[model samples]
Target: MSKIKDTSVNFENKKNLEETCAEIYAVNLISGQWILSICYYLKQGKLRFTELKNKIPNITERMLTLQLKKMEEDKLVSRTAYAEVPLRVEYELTPIGKGLLPILAQLEQWGKLHKSMSEGSAT
Candidate 1:
Protein backbone atom coordinates (compact mmCIF):
# COMPACT_ATOMS: atom_id res chain seq x y z
CA MET A 1 0.00 0.00 0.00
CA SER A 2 1.12 3.56 -0.65
CA LYS A 3 2.05 5.75 2.29
CA ILE A 4 -0.48 8.42 3.28
CA LYS A 5 0.25 12.08 4.06
CA ASP A 6 1.05 12.48 7.79
CA THR A 7 0.30 16.20 7.99
CA SER A 8 -2.85 17.30 9.80
CA VAL A 9 -2.84 20.55 7.83
CA ASN A 10 -3.01 18.68 4.55
CA PHE A 11 -5.90 16.56 5.82
CA GLU A 12 -7.80 19.61 7.04
CA ASN A 13 -7.32 21.40 3.74
CA LYS A 14 -8.56 18.38 1.82
CA LYS A 15 -11.61 18.14 4.06
CA ASN A 16 -12.33 21.84 3.67
CA LEU A 17 -12.10 21.63 -0.12
CA GLU A 18 -14.54 18.71 -0.26
CA GLU A 19 -16.94 20.44 2.12
CA THR A 20 -16.88 23.64 0.09
CA CYS A 21 -17.62 21.76 -3.12
CA ALA A 22 -20.50 19.94 -1.44
CA GLU A 23 -21.86 23.20 -0.07
CA ILE A 24 -21.68 24.81 -3.49
CA TYR A 25 -23.54 21.92 -5.05
CA ALA A 26 -26.11 21.95 -2.26
CA VAL A 27 -26.87 25.69 -2.63
CA ASN A 28 -30.48 24.67 -3.36
CA LEU A 29 -30.82 25.52 -7.03
CA ILE A 30 -33.47 22.89 -7.60
CA SER A 31 -35.09 23.20 -4.18
CA GLY A 32 -37.32 25.97 -5.46
CA GLN A 33 -39.51 25.39 -8.51
CA TRP A 34 -38.86 28.85 -9.95
CA ILE A 35 -35.08 28.55 -9.71
CA LEU A 36 -34.75 25.32 -11.65
CA SER A 37 -37.35 26.48 -14.13
CA ILE A 38 -35.59 29.82 -14.42
CA CYS A 39 -32.30 28.12 -15.13
CA TYR A 40 -34.01 25.90 -17.67
CA TYR A 41 -35.33 28.92 -19.54
CA LEU A 42 -32.07 30.87 -19.21
CA LYS A 43 -30.19 28.01 -20.78
CA GLN A 44 -32.17 28.90 -23.87
CA GLY A 45 -31.89 32.71 -23.54
CA LYS A 46 -32.20 35.66 -21.23
CA LEU A 47 -35.67 36.62 -19.98
CA ARG A 48 -37.42 39.36 -18.07
CA PHE A 49 -39.28 38.66 -14.84
CA THR A 50 -42.65 38.87 -16.55
CA GLU A 51 -41.59 36.41 -19.21
CA LEU A 52 -40.28 34.05 -16.62
CA LYS A 53 -43.51 34.36 -14.70
CA ASN A 54 -45.45 33.52 -17.85
CA LYS A 55 -43.38 30.40 -18.34
CA ILE A 56 -43.88 29.28 -14.76
CA PRO A 57 -47.44 30.28 -14.06
CA ASN A 58 -47.80 28.50 -10.76
CA ILE A 59 -44.88 30.18 -8.99
CA THR A 60 -45.69 33.05 -6.70
CA GLU A 61 -44.02 36.42 -7.25
CA ARG A 62 -42.58 36.27 -3.75
CA MET A 63 -41.09 32.85 -4.34
CA LEU A 64 -39.59 33.85 -7.67
CA THR A 65 -38.13 36.98 -6.10
CA LEU A 66 -36.57 34.99 -3.28
CA GLN A 67 -35.17 32.30 -5.57
CA LEU A 68 -33.70 34.85 -7.97
CA LYS A 69 -32.08 36.66 -5.08
CA LYS A 70 -30.50 33.47 -3.81
CA MET A 71 -29.35 32.43 -7.26
CA GLU A 72 -27.75 35.85 -7.73
CA GLU A 73 -26.00 35.49 -4.43
CA ASP A 74 -24.67 32.08 -5.49
CA LYS A 75 -23.33 33.60 -8.75
CA LEU A 76 -25.42 31.12 -10.71
CA VAL A 77 -27.35 33.86 -12.46
CA SER A 78 -26.70 37.45 -13.56
CA ARG A 79 -29.18 40.17 -12.91
CA THR A 80 -29.01 43.15 -15.26
CA ALA A 81 -30.78 46.32 -14.24
CA TYR A 82 -31.30 48.87 -16.98
CA ALA A 83 -31.82 52.59 -16.56
CA GLU A 84 -34.34 53.13 -19.28
CA VAL A 85 -37.49 55.19 -19.37
CA PRO A 86 -39.58 52.41 -17.92
CA LEU A 87 -36.63 50.53 -16.41
CA ARG A 88 -36.07 46.98 -17.60
CA VAL A 89 -34.39 44.07 -15.90
CA GLU A 90 -33.28 40.74 -17.30
CA TYR A 91 -31.83 37.54 -15.93
CA GLU A 92 -29.32 35.21 -17.55
CA LEU A 93 -27.08 32.37 -16.53
CA THR A 94 -23.53 33.19 -15.51
CA PRO A 95 -20.66 31.09 -16.88
CA ILE A 96 -20.76 29.00 -13.73
CA GLY A 97 -24.46 28.39 -14.18
CA LYS A 98 -23.94 27.53 -17.84
CA GLY A 99 -21.33 25.01 -16.75
CA LEU A 100 -24.08 23.13 -14.92
CA LEU A 101 -26.07 22.49 -18.12
CA PRO A 102 -24.29 19.31 -19.14
CA ILE A 103 -24.69 17.84 -15.66
CA LEU A 104 -28.34 18.83 -15.60
CA ALA A 105 -28.87 17.28 -19.03
CA GLN A 106 -27.35 14.02 -17.86
CA LEU A 107 -29.56 14.03 -14.79
CA GLU A 108 -32.64 14.67 -16.95
CA GLN A 109 -31.71 11.78 -19.22
CA TRP A 110 -31.17 9.52 -16.26
CA GLY A 111 -34.54 10.51 -14.81
CA LYS A 112 -36.27 9.61 -18.06
CA LEU A 113 -34.47 6.28 -18.23
CA HIS A 114 -35.36 5.54 -14.62
CA LYS A 115 -39.01 6.39 -15.21
CA SER A 116 -39.18 4.17 -18.28
CA MET A 117 -37.58 1.31 -16.41
CA SER A 118 -39.94 1.74 -13.49
CA GLU A 119 -42.97 1.70 -15.79
CA GLY A 120 -41.68 -1.35 -17.64
CA SER A 121 -41.12 -3.17 -14.38
CA ALA A 122 -44.63 -2.30 -13.24
CA THR A 123 -46.06 -3.65 -16.47
Candidate 2:
Protein backbone atom coordinates (compact mmCIF):
# COMPACT_ATOMS: atom_id res chain seq x y z
CA MET A 1 0.00 0.00 0.00
CA SER A 2 1.15 3.52 -0.74
CA LYS A 3 1.77 5.83 2.17
CA ILE A 4 -0.53 8.84 2.48
CA LYS A 5 1.43 11.68 3.95
CA ASP A 6 -0.48 13.53 6.63
CA THR A 7 0.33 16.81 4.94
CA SER A 8 -1.14 15.76 1.59
CA VAL A 9 -4.42 17.07 0.16
CA ASN A 10 -5.81 13.55 -0.30
CA PHE A 11 -5.12 12.82 3.32
CA GLU A 12 -6.88 15.99 4.38
CA ASN A 13 -9.96 15.14 2.32
CA LYS A 14 -10.03 11.62 3.68
CA LYS A 15 -9.74 12.88 7.23
CA ASN A 16 -12.53 15.36 6.70
CA LEU A 17 -14.86 12.79 5.16
CA GLU A 18 -14.14 10.23 7.85
CA GLU A 19 -14.73 12.73 10.59
CA THR A 20 -17.97 14.10 9.22
CA CYS A 21 -19.67 10.98 7.90
CA ALA A 22 -20.58 8.13 10.18
CA GLU A 23 -21.06 5.67 7.30
CA ILE A 24 -17.81 6.71 5.67
CA TYR A 25 -16.05 6.40 8.99
CA ALA A 26 -17.39 2.90 9.45
CA VAL A 27 -16.30 1.96 5.95
CA ASN A 28 -12.85 3.36 6.57
CA LEU A 29 -12.36 1.02 9.51
CA ILE A 30 -12.50 -2.03 7.23
CA SER A 31 -11.25 -0.57 3.97
CA GLY A 32 -8.92 -3.03 2.30
CA GLN A 33 -9.06 -5.90 -0.19
CA TRP A 34 -8.50 -8.64 2.35
CA ILE A 35 -9.98 -7.19 5.53
CA LEU A 36 -13.62 -8.14 4.99
CA SER A 37 -12.61 -11.55 3.68
CA ILE A 38 -10.42 -12.13 6.69
CA CYS A 39 -13.29 -11.10 8.89
CA TYR A 40 -15.59 -13.55 7.10
CA TYR A 41 -13.30 -16.46 7.90
CA LEU A 42 -12.62 -15.33 11.44
CA LYS A 43 -16.36 -15.28 12.04
CA GLN A 44 -16.05 -19.05 12.05
CA GLY A 45 -13.41 -19.15 14.81
CA LYS A 46 -9.93 -18.06 15.79
CA LEU A 47 -7.23 -19.06 13.34
CA ARG A 48 -3.47 -19.19 13.44
CA PHE A 49 -1.27 -17.49 10.87
CA THR A 50 -0.79 -20.56 8.68
CA GLU A 51 -4.45 -21.46 8.83
CA LEU A 52 -5.33 -18.00 7.62
CA LYS A 53 -2.71 -18.40 4.91
CA ASN A 54 -4.37 -21.63 3.80
CA LYS A 55 -7.74 -19.91 3.72
CA ILE A 56 -6.40 -17.09 1.58
CA PRO A 57 -3.83 -18.76 -0.55
CA ASN A 58 -3.37 -15.93 -3.00
CA ILE A 59 -2.39 -13.27 -0.49
CA THR A 60 1.27 -12.85 0.22
CA GLU A 61 2.48 -13.45 3.75
CA ARG A 62 3.66 -9.83 3.96
CA MET A 63 0.26 -8.49 2.93
CA LEU A 64 -1.54 -10.73 5.42
CA THR A 65 0.82 -9.60 8.17
CA LEU A 66 0.30 -5.97 7.25
CA GLN A 67 -3.49 -6.27 7.10
CA LEU A 68 -3.66 -8.16 10.41
CA LYS A 69 -1.47 -5.53 12.04
CA LYS A 70 -3.69 -2.79 10.68
CA MET A 71 -6.84 -4.50 11.98
CA GLU A 72 -5.18 -4.94 15.39
CA GLU A 73 -4.38 -1.23 15.47
CA ASP A 74 -7.96 -0.37 14.54
CA LYS A 75 -9.25 -2.64 17.34
CA LEU A 76 -11.21 -4.74 14.85
CA VAL A 77 -9.09 -7.83 15.45
CA SER A 78 -7.19 -9.22 18.38
CA ARG A 79 -3.97 -11.19 18.24
CA THR A 80 -2.92 -13.64 20.91
CA ALA A 81 0.61 -14.95 21.11
CA TYR A 82 1.33 -18.01 23.20
CA ALA A 83 4.70 -18.66 24.75
CA GLU A 84 5.39 -22.30 24.04
CA VAL A 85 7.99 -24.52 22.45
CA PRO A 86 6.84 -23.90 18.90
CA LEU A 87 5.47 -20.40 19.52
CA ARG A 88 1.80 -20.30 18.59
CA VAL A 89 -0.16 -17.20 17.66
CA GLU A 90 -3.82 -16.79 16.78
CA TYR A 91 -6.05 -14.11 15.34
CA GLU A 92 -9.72 -13.49 15.96
CA LEU A 93 -12.22 -10.71 15.59
CA THR A 94 -13.02 -8.46 18.49
CA PRO A 95 -16.68 -8.06 19.47
CA ILE A 96 -16.80 -4.84 17.52
CA GLY A 97 -15.56 -6.80 14.54
CA LYS A 98 -18.14 -9.53 15.05
CA GLY A 99 -20.76 -6.80 14.85
CA LEU A 100 -19.83 -6.25 11.24
CA LEU A 101 -20.95 -9.69 10.02
CA PRO A 102 -24.58 -8.79 9.35
CA ILE A 103 -23.58 -5.57 7.66
CA LEU A 104 -21.07 -7.46 5.56
CA ALA A 105 -23.70 -9.96 4.51
CA GLN A 106 -25.94 -7.14 3.36
CA LEU A 107 -23.09 -5.55 1.47
CA GLU A 108 -22.36 -8.86 -0.22
CA GLN A 109 -25.95 -9.14 -1.34
CA TRP A 110 -25.91 -5.61 -2.70
CA GLY A 111 -22.68 -6.24 -4.56
CA LYS A 112 -24.04 -9.35 -6.23
CA LEU A 113 -27.26 -7.62 -7.25
CA HIS A 114 -25.42 -4.60 -8.59
CA LYS A 115 -22.96 -6.73 -10.54
CA SER A 116 -25.71 -8.80 -12.09
CA MET A 117 -27.68 -5.72 -13.07
CA SER A 118 -24.63 -4.12 -14.60
CA GLU A 119 -23.84 -7.24 -16.55
CA GLY A 120 -27.41 -7.59 -17.79
CA SER A 121 -27.45 -4.01 -19.00
CA ALA A 122 -24.20 -4.46 -20.85
CA THR A 123 -25.57 -7.36 -22.93
* Model 1 root-mean-square deviation: 9.1
* Candidate maximizing TM-score: 2
Per-residue C-alpha lDDT of model 2 across residues 1-123, encoded as one tens digit per residue? 777999999999999999999999999888888998899899998999999999999999999999999999999899999999799999999999999999999999999999999999999
Q: Give, for candidate 2, the lowest lDDT window spanning 10 residues.
A: 28-37
Q: Give candidate 2 regions above 4 Å deviation.
A: none
- Give per-model TM-scores: 0.77, 0.94
Q: How does residue 31 of candidate 1 score in lDDT?
A: 55
Clashes of each: 0, 0
Expressed as tens digits, the lDDT of each residue in 55-101 for candidate 1 is 98998888788888889998899999999978899999999989878
